[model samples]
Structure formats: structure tokens, C-alpha cells
Target chain A: MKTKKHENHTYIIESEDMERKNEMLLQYIKEKVNQLLQIMGTKPLRDEELNDESLIAIDPIGIIAESFEQVLDHLKESNRQLQLARDYLQAVFDTAGVGISIIDRDLKIIKCNEKQKELLVNGVSQIEGRHCYEVYCGIDSPPLICPAIETLEMERAVFLKEVTKKGKVFQIVTSPLRDRSGSISGVIEVSMDITEKKRALEAMCQSEKLAAVGQLAAGIAHELNNPLGNILGYAKLLLMEQDTTEFQKNRLEVIIEQAKRGSSIIKGLLEFSHQKMPVFERISLNACIELALRSLSDEIRSNNIEILTGLGTVPYVMADPKQMEQVIYNILLNAIQALEGKGGIVEIKSEALNGSVEVTIKDNGPGIPKEHLSRIFEPFFTTKPVGKGTGLGLSICAEILKKHSSNICVESEVGKGTKFSFRIMGGVTGNV
Target chain B: MADKSGINLDVINLDIRGQICPACLLISLKEINKHKGLLRDGEANLIVKTDHRDATRTIPDAAIAMGYAVFVEKKKGYYEITVGRKDEDQKA
Candidate 1:
């Protein structure tokens, strides 16, 4: 019996030693797992590590069980945070107003936001893994001035580029997307449609020009009126003299004619001096063009310039007849002057569109220079020499059309003819 | 009436004060021309004061060319030119 009791005590001591060793092994595994989790910046693995073939072969069963439970709790907490972060990022990308796109180093689009998807409807699903130029610009290769490739190569944010696609203007900015070690992995492109901003800027410029004209009108008119009054006074006084011979009467008539010419010039100056409030009416565009042509008929015929009319049968537009006349007249006069006595064809075409009317005035005169075409409608910008042009004709026409909720656009190629097309809203009824 | 009082109107009193130079006298003459009728009438007299003595000679010559009579008077070290009507009866 003494031998049996001693044997049982030995067994109990051995079992306690085994249990203590198992607890130490478990503590060591938990510490190692915590350290690894911190280093890897990943969620803690649960029974996965214990079940792993390499770990299971080295660790005891009891220690593996305890370490598994602790790791499971940590993994659950980490997973919850990761899910929250992922949801927040997805929400931001889904609802952002600016179109966002991610492209690889090869310029292939890897990811994109909802706005980007909205902008590209055709082949949008197939856009992924495709080159950005092929997908967005509908080109076989990237453009020469691509902002995305620049951002990647330079490894920094690049300036915004204005791009016109499908008649809509967009301001696109690109930045390099870096990896964990700050190495350039790809490019992040953001495109904002700035068409409205561009239109607003143009409108602001027009208003400023109008303000300047208003302030200078009084002074210019006063200066012009003095000379005009002198001419008219002397001409009338000569006409009223009774001793005027036939030869003298002819000279007097010439003086009167010259005075009237001066008066007309003053009228033009005065017209530019005031703030013009355009009156809108449902008027025929053909009549407007005819009146414009009539005003310039003598000049056109004298210059031997042929006028070609392609007036389309169109409905009348709700427009100010007088202002529209001015618009047409200004363009016609410019065309005549551009001919420079070496007459060319002036072709006028009018077409009624779905929501607007398009009037195109084309001249085969010496086309505007490439650099000057963009600033043709800018106030006080003229290619003509001093005393021959005021440089305000096209600008005034642009201002008038803009007041009527219209716009003037010019397309010209140097050495080729220039075309000026303007559109006016067809249904608008109120005066501007 | 011409010989009633033996007071010969040999010289007229013209005060041209606050005139700095010939340019200032010209500016003053322009302002005076704006009130041509008033100057033509004897009811008002031109009193021009100038800091420079040379303006006294220039103002009188300019006034005469514009058909006005002028006389210079020096007071308190300042030159004055009085511009009067060409004729007293011509006042309107």
C-alpha cells in the first residue's frame, strides 16, 4: 500500500509539470503572434496558425488551443475596423463629383469612380485594363500631352490641362499614386467639367468691355461733335449764300456730302458710347441678313466682291432685329474690309437647329493669323491698321449676341478662309 | 463829360494774385473766357495775383489779344493785373 501511494503522488507531480510547460508554450506563442501582427499590420490569425501544418507539428495541443482563442478575438476586432475603413473609402469614391480614375504605369485604367463611369458610357465595363487614351480619348495611343504619363514619370502632381471632349471642356489634374515605400505605382487622374466656368469668364470679360465703352462714350462723342459741327455749319452757310455759281454750287454740294460723311462717323462713335439694351422680337433672320447686306452693298460692289447667300428656309427666331442686324452688319463689314480691295466671296448661311439658329458668315479673304484668331473677339483687338478699324466691331457683335443668350465662335486656318458662326436661342422672347 | 474832372484815366488797376507762372496765367485766362460776358461788362473786374513778376507782362498781352483792357498794380510784394472791359459802354 505504501508503494501504491508513492507511485500515485509521482504521477500527479509529473502531470502538473506537463500542465505548467503547456501554459508557458501558449504564452510564448501569443506574444509571437502579437509581435507578428504589429509588424505585418494585418489582422491576427485565429486557429488558422494552430491548424497550419508547420505550427501544428512544432506546438503542443493545449498551448495551440489557448493561443487560438486569444488570436480569434484580436482578429475579429481588426476585421471590424478594416471593414469600416473600406466602407468609408467606397462611399467617398462612389459619391465624389469629380471624375476620378486610376491608371497603371502602362497608362491602362485600373479603377475609376462613378462620375468617370457616367462620363464614358460606351465600353465602360471594358474600360478596365485598357489604355486611358483608347478608352477615354478614343485613340489608339496616348496623346502627346497626356497628364497621366507625366505624373507617373515625374513622380509628382502635374498641372491641370484643359481638354475638350464631345464639345464639353474639362479641367483634368493628375497626381502620382505611390506604393507603401513611396515609389510611384500608378497615376490618379481627376477631371472636372469647367464648361460653365469658361462661359462665365467670357461673360465677365464682355461686361467689363461694355463698362469701359460706357465711360469713354461721353468724352469721345464730345470730341467728335465739335469737328462735325464745324463742318456742317460752314457747309450750310455756303449753301445759303445767294451768289453761288453753278461751279461753286457743285463745290458746296461736295462740302455738304463730306460733312454728312463726318456726321455718319460721329453716329458710329456715339453708338459705341452708350450702354445698349437689346430689344428682342420674333424676327426673320433672312430680313436681318438682307438689311446688313444692303448697308454694305455699295462697298461690296465698289470692291467687286461677290456676295453668296445660302439662306435656309427657317422659322423666325426670337431675337432683337436691330441688334441682330448689327451683328450681321459687323461681320459683313469685317469681311469687306478683310478683302482689302482685292475682293473675295462673302458667303452667308443660316440654319434653324433644334434649340437654336446657326448663322455662318464665311469670307475667302486673307485668313486671320493663327495667333490672332483666338483674340479676334477681344475688345480693342484688331488686325487692321489705325484709322481704318476701331477694333471694336467684332467685340460689340459678340457682346450683343451674348446679351441675347447667344455665343459667337470662330474657326479659321491661316492661308485658308475664316468662318464665324453664332447661335441664338430660338424660343427666348424677352429683351436683353 | 469828358473834361468834367481833370482825372486822366492813364492807368488801370489790375490785380493778378495766386498766379505762379505763365502756365498759371494761361489757365486763368481760359477760366476767364468761360465767363466772357461777365468780363465784357464793367460790372465785374479781373483781379489776378501772381507769385512771379513775369506773369504780369504775359497776362496783359494775352488779355489784349482777347480784346480786353488790362492794367498791372504791385502791392505787398505781389503783382496784380486788373482786367477791365474794352469800353465801359460796351458792357452787356
Candidate 2:
């Protein structure tokens, strides 16, 4: 007999270890035979050579080993599934368009996704483990009314709110991250960039205010028309009476001139506030522009401002022909005024782009200052001196364009030039 | 002919202070038209007391159109508008 120890396990086998492979098989058979002897309904059988071709009875040890293997396989499958779920959640967090961040009760960021990093840091630095205020507001401390703090204190979710920080607008929604027992542990903050939306809302509000003022102007103008008309009529009548003295005649002349001025002012007011129900028809934009220019032909000629047109074959737009002509006339007049008699080129261009007909009026003159651009559409807001302009021309243009479901946008640079562009959606069927 | 002086006694005065536009002008015009016969005869003058600034313009303009000479005097708290027909001023 030979004995050997390897890897802390003792092996008893035939001297040639390869020939003793069936030693465990013999032990398995012995255990089975002993079990059969204990059962009253079984008959004991003699043991013979146990070869690969011979079938051995099922053993208790073999059953235990098979069960153990199945349990291990199930654990591996569960681990693989759990790993897949984690990867899927991570992908969603990273690719979400809105900014998302997780912060601890200390207001320190624990985790943040790509959009959060881009919005807060402008893609400059990784923001994890830093203070939330420093990343978001560029401040040392969070404001007292911070939504994250509010959520933590209330232990509930906070609704989305618009917040302006660092000259940008964000819509913030905060929720309390709680433990299993419902105790708040941290906060999850989601934010979306809303600066453009905020600007549009402000523009809409300004338009509404201008509309109200325009309506008031129209009402006042209508009321004054009667008295103003009477004044002019009577002044003319008095002047025609062949009065005795020239003094009365001079007074009458003055009265007549002032009354005419008042009438013109009323005319401007009516133009600004008049909201006629639009009679929609497909009209040629190029024809309207040419007509508006023809009406201002005298001013254009006297001022020596060149009228250049690039009227491409644009499809007709759905609009009231009369009102749309007014819009074109106002823009062209504005361009001429910007020239200020310096004799520059006023270029008009119309084309079809992206399912809309766009008309652009460009002037090579002293451009409007940047600050005044935003308020140019407001009624009575003017750069012209008193008695020169009623300041309602552009506003009336805006009102008409708004009725057509369009908007006017201006781009200008001081000392360079200015361009005003408006788009009217093209009508279906291409022509009337 | 014009009376550059001011409103004196013997003129019919209608006070319209605290009344807002259009309304003030309406009432003032009504009074002036009521005295049309006397005004044409050079026997009566019409004066209106109104605080509405717009009435100062509207009333005078309306009166002048009806063959009357109008004068506006801005007082301490309101405007005093006096109107007389051209014939009355000529007689005075």
C-alpha cells in the first residue's frame, strides 16, 4: 500500500491511482444495497462487476449533487438579469434631454447626468460631490427659497417652477428621495431650459398690452372725429363769409390748420387700432409689395432712395389683400425713414422657404440701436421727434401680421444696417 | 370779432366738474344748443365749468362750428369755457 497527500485531501485508491476510479462507485453501490436490505418489500440481490455497460441503481448522494447544481444555475441567471436592469436604467439617466441630479441632505450633489453637467457647467467640469448652489446658481449658498430645500423640509414633491439664474431661465421640479421607512434622505432635482419660452411669453404679454392701447386710441379717435370735423367745416365756413377784418381770417386759418392736424392724428389712431375681420384670399405678395411701393413712389423718388426688388416667383399667401398691403407699406416706410434722406438702397426680397412665403425689407442706413429693437412694435414707441411720426405704423403692421398668424422679426447693428423679415404661411392649392 | 376779456356776469354758467369726457362734452353742447335762440339774438352767453381736459378742446371746437366764438380760461381747479355767437360778439 502507498499513501500520498495533495492539496489537503487524502486519497485511498489502488497503488495505480487511475485504476481506482471506481472506488467511490463501489461505496455508492454498498450504500444502496444496505438501504434495500432495510426495506421490508425489497429482496436483496448479489453484487457483480459494475462496468460502464451495467446499470447501477439510483444513489442518494447522486440525487443531492443534482439538486445542488440546479440551485447554482438559478443564482447565476438571477445575477445576470439584475446586471441587465442596472445597465438599462443607467442608459436612460445619461441620455435624458432634461437635466437630472441627485443631491444629499447637505445640498451636495451625489450624482448628475450628462445634460445636467452641460447645463450647470456649460460642459466645463464634472459637478459631482460639489455644492448644488455653486453648480447651478454660481453662488456660495443656496437661496432660502430653494426648491430642493423646500422639498426636504416638506418631505413631499415640489411642482415645477420657473427660476432665473445667471441670465438663463430654468423650470425646476424637485422631489424628496426617501428611505424604505419614508424618511427623506435626499432630493432628486429635474430642470429644463425655458429661456426661449420665457421670452415668447413676455413678447405675447407685450403684444396684448399694445393691442389694448390701440383699441383705446381707436375709440378716442372715432369720438373726436365728429367734433374735429365740425371744427374744420366751421372754420372753412367762417373764412368764406367775407368777414370785415383780416384778423378773424388769420385766426380762422390757424384753426383750420390745427383741426387738420388733429384729423390726421385721428387717422393714425384708427389705422393702429382698426381690427377688421380678415377676408382670407390667396393674393400675390409681389403685387402687393409693388403696389405699396407705387403708392410711396413720390417719397422714394424725392428722397433718392433706390428701390431694389428680388421678387422671386413666390406662391400666394393666405391673407387680406388690403391689410397685407398695409403691412408691406409700413415696413417699406420704416426702411425709408431709417435712411433719413441720406439716399441709400432699400432692398425688398420675397421667396418661398420651409412652407412659408418670406418677405424681407433691408435698408442700408443708420441701423436701429439694439436696445430699441425689442420695443419697436409697441404703439407710440418711436425714435422720431414729435410731430414727425405718430409711432403707430410698426405697431399696426405687427397687429395685421399677428392676425395672419405671422410674426415680424428685426435684426440690426448700429452703423451697419437693419433688416426686417416676416413670414406668411403659404396657401394650399398654390393660387386663387 | 373776439372778446379777449373774460367771463363776466349775465352769462349762463353750467358747471360740469368731475364729469368724464364725452359725457361732459355732451352736456355742455346740449346747454349751448339750448340757448341757441338767445345766443343768435345777442341776448345771452354760455359758460361751462369742466375739469376734463379733453372737454376743453372738444367743447370749444364744437361751439365754434355752430357759429359761436369760443374762449378757454384755465382756472385754479378747472377750465371755464365761454361761448358766444359771432353776431353777439360783433354787437358787444
Candidate 3:
């Protein structure tokens, strides 16, 4: 038994009575209501009745039950629509051609598209949560001018003109990602592969430089010719005088030889400057190539470079024989030099294709770097050390090929090799 | 233009601006030859100013070849060449 005292009154309660009172008389009432609910078997309790304690407390009888049911139904429909929108956005993200990535403020890649995975990370799985600099640049730290870093640091959009990574060029744009509070959270990077565009820009710049150099060379060569000739003639006259000592005669002979050499260089400059037009004639390219190869037979033999010539059915083209020979000779010399004296294979293949004669020169040697490949055809641009290269050979070849209505293009992969290819249109008679 | 430098001597001023190469050299030579009498007596000097780069080399070389004492001074965008006969003392 238990006794509880109140103001001016006392009540006695037995333990059995207390237990009966705590047994929840409301539960019996709930059972009676459930029996009535069983008549409507398809109706489930509203979510507010089960999980929302606050709503249950505010309205014990569920006076707002209908309203809560309608609200829950509306929320369900809105969620379905939102899920559909999310799926549509996901499809667009996956199907985009350009590489797109979202990076967190800590420079970790949070999300990337299919193109980003394929082109940037070399199709590596599990790129998410990896550091962006490590995946894109292969460096442990971000480069000095990384667009993502700049966007995050400056809290603005940043654009990079051209960035070369893994031997491919890309135009990158990055913008800051902001949270609902209007604070930057991360950066979104969009990159487009622009290798072909970069190559075109390089070619334009190279041709401009070549033109300026040619104009200057032509002016100087013309002025130098008269002085060089006067020097040569005077030296010859002095050499012809019999009343001269042996020492004096030797000096005059040396002067004459040097002046003659200068004259030859001036002649080459004139040709390079396009002052002399090539006299075009229908010629067999195979024969011209053979003649040029013959001229370098000794050098090739000494260097032990294996020459593989694959001459297919080739058509005759309208070309200047001497200039064409020079072109072949220059490209062959370049191929030999690329071998670096360690001895490698030089492949020369000529074939007729697409109404033109195509020539390809491939070498298994140290390949050119991506940075230098663009400027290789520009005059005075060379990778060789000082005194080892004149830097005019390829420019001259390009000039000659341009005159023949053809163009030279190179494909090189670092540490693999280089391939130079050109096409020259055939004459009026296809088989001439 | 001649001035008295505490001595009665003559100076000839020749200007060949906007002239190119050998023309500037040739004109400077003509002026030097015209004052040859004063030059021989060591009574005058020839000063020629030209804005041609080639003339800087050609005029000096031609003047030196013709047995004249030449001095070249480069001014802003131009050259001043002074020519005189070898002094008797210098010849000795």
C-alpha cells in the first residue's frame, strides 16, 4: 500500500490499484478505434501520426490529419519531379564532349565527366577524391598558373589560353562555386582540347617570322654582292701579279677563296628569299630522291643508318629538279641528324594517292618536344646546340615545298620518333 | 660657316640629310675636294652631317683612302664627319 498526502487530505492507494491505473485506459480506447479503422483496411496512418511527435502533441485527436495528408502527397510529387530533373542534368554532364570537373577548395577532384576521365587522367578509374594537380599535371603540387587555383583564390572566373599536358593542348576555364550563403565553396573547371588550334596559331606565327627574316636577308644580300665581287676581283688581280712574295700570294688566295664562299652563301640567301623563281619541269620524284640519296651515301654509310626506301607506284609532278633534289637532301640530312649517331632506321616512302604524290620520311630517333615542334619550320629556330646547326635547312625545305603547291607537316611523340610527310600535286597529265 | 678660333682658319659646312648610301658619300667628297686648296694649306676643315647609316662607313673609308685625316662623331639619329689634310707635323 502507498499513501500520498495532499493539502488537508490524504489518499491511500494499493500497489495493485496503481498498476491498474498505469495500464493506460487510453490504450483500450485506441483498440476500440482500431477496430473501427479495420473496417477501412486500405487506409494507413498518416506519417505525422507515426513520426511527428510535435504534430501529435499539438493535436492529440489529429484535427489536422487531412491537411497533413495533402501536404505529404504534395511533397512526394515534388520529390519525384526533382529526381527526374536530377537524372536529366546527369545525362547532360556525362554526354558533354568537353572535359568538366568540379574541384573542392582543398584542390581535390570531387566530380568529373567521361571526357575528363578519358583525356586527362588517362582513363584511370577512381579519379574522384584525388588531387587535381597530381592527375592533370602529374606534379605533386599545382602549377604556378593553374586555373582552378586562380578561380578559388580570386573568387572569380579564370581562363587559360592554352595549356599543354601529356603532349596535348587544352583551353581551360574555371569558375568559383558558391554556396547558398554566397561564399565560395569550390571551383568548376571546363577544358577543351585545342591541339589543332594551337598548331594553326603556331604555323601563322612561324610564317610571319620567316617572311620578316627573308625580307631582311634579301636586302642585305643584295648590298653585300657588289662589295664581295669587288673584293674577289681585286684579290684575283693581286694573286696574278708575279712580283709578289709567297706569303703575300697565299694571303690573296685565301681572300679569294673566302669571297667565293661568301658569294655562294649569298646565292643560297637569294634563293631562300624567293628572289629567284624555280623553273618548273615535269620530273620523276623517285629519280630525284635517288640522286639526293647518292650524294649522302658516304655519310649514311659512316653513320651506319639503315636506309629503307619504299617506292610505290608514284606519278610524275611538275617540280624544279634542282630544288626538289635539295628538298629531299635537306630532309634526309635532318633524319640522319635526328639519329644522334647511335644508328637507327630511316624510312623513306613515296606513293601516289588522291591525285598527288606523297612523300614520307620517318626516323626512329629522339623525338622533338611539343614546345619546339611548332617553331621547327621557322627560320633560325633550332634545338641543336650552338655551332651544330644552321637552322635554315627545314625553312628552306618548307619554302621549296610551298612553291610546289604542297605543305610539310610533322608528327612526333617524345621518346618514340618523328615523321615528316608532304604532298605534291601531279602535273596536268596524271601519269606524266 | 667659318669662325675665328684665335686663328684665321676657314670651315666648310656640308649637310646631306635624307640622302642614302653612296650619294651621301659622293656629296661629302665633292665638298672636301672643293675646299682642297684651303685643306692643303691647313687653313680650312670640312664638316659634313648625314643621316645615312651606310654613309657612316663609306664616307670615312673614302676620305681615309684619299689621304685625309677624318674624325666621325655620332649625334642623335645622325653622323658628323670632319675631314682635313694631314698636318705637316703629322706627316713628319
Tens digits of per-residue lDDT for model 3, A10-38: 44345456667755554554443334233
Kindly list the per-residue Cα lDDT of model 2 for residues A2-48, writing each as its tens digit: 56667334454434464565667766665564353223112232344
The TM-score values for the models, in the order shown, are 0.53, 0.49, 0.57
Point out the worst 10-residue segment of candidate 1 chain B by lDDT.
Answer: B1-10
Hey, what RMSD does candidate 3 come out at?
Answer: 39.1
Per-candidate chain B TM: 0.69, 0.81, 0.79
Each prediction's whole-model lDDT (CA):
0.72, 0.76, 0.76
What DockQ does each listed candidate score?
Answer: 0.00, 0.00, 0.00
Interface RMSD of each: 51.3, 57.5, 54.6
TM-score winner between candidates 1 and 2: 1
| Predicted candidate 1 versus true structure: per-residue lDDT over A362-432, tens digit per residue | 99988998779767887668888766776778877877887888888888776678899998777754221
Docking quality category of candidate 3 according to DockQ thresholds: incorrect
Q: Could you tell me the lDDT of residue A352 within candidate 2?
A: 88
Q: Give the clash count for each candidate.
A: 17, 0, 0
